[model samples]
Structures are given as structure tokens and as C-alpha cells.
Target: MKKTITFAMLHFGVAFTITYLLTGSWVLGGAVALIEPAVNTVVFYFHEKAWKRAESKQLPLAA
Candidate 1:
């Protein structure tokens, strides 16, 4: 969770800085900011699902 949030924020900051420099418009920068979190959420969701599936396959035998 923390890793995902950090990754998202880093992406947003870099993108926002670049967009602000190129466009000089906060509104556009704000719009660009939305992309990072959306992408991060999708990535994290899939990552979690994959991890869960892998973990489930590793169960030990019962007595």
C-alpha cells in the first residue's frame, strides 16, 4: 500500500512539474495529475490479485 502510494505520488509530481513547465496552466497540470493515481490503482489491484493467487497455490498439506 505504501509502495503504491509512493510510486503514484512520485509519478504525479514528475508529470505535474513537466506539464506545468510546458503548459504554464495549473488546470492542465491538475488534469495530468489524475493519470498517476488511476494508473497506480489499476497496477496495484492486479499486483495484489496476482500475489493472492500465487500465495493460494503454496498452501501446506493438512494432517
Candidate 2:
């Protein structure tokens, strides 16, 4: 989706900015911009699965 692509770009910018600020190396900044998001994507997938599992285990309250 178009939105998803831009969202990835935004994350890249953030990662690049932070890494650049800390290390002052373009190569490191680029590396983190790609690697960090890749790692986060995997972590986020698992995190979402855990959240869904927790939500499913909750009982509904009586009205």
C-alpha cells in the first residue's frame, strides 16, 4: 500500500537521524536505518501476536 511505503520511509529517516547524530557516520546511519527497522518489523509482528492472544483470553463483562 502507498501508506505503508511512506511509513517505512519515515522510520528510515528517524533511524538515520538518530544514528547519524550519535555516530556521525553515513554508512553506520544507513546500516541502522535499514537493519533497525528490519529487526523492529519482526519484533512488532510477534508483539502484535502476543497482544491479540492476550485480548482473546480476556472475558467479557456482563452489562
The best candidate in terms of lDDT: 2
Regions of candidate 1 where Cα sits further than 4 Å from its true position: 44-63
TM-score per candidate, chains pooled: 0.59, 0.72
Please provide, for model 1 over 3-23, each residue's C-alpha lDDT reduced to its tens digit, 9 standing for 90 to 100.
Answer: 677777787888888898999
Candidates in order have lDDT scores of 0.82, 0.84
Model 1, CA-based lDDT: 0.82
Q: Tens-digit lDDT track for model 2 on 1-63?
A: 454456667888999999999999999999999999867766766777889899999999999
State model 2's lDDT: 0.84
User: Which segments of candidate 2 are over 4 A away from where they belong?
Assistant: 1-7, 61-63
Indicate the TM-score of model 1. Answer: 0.59
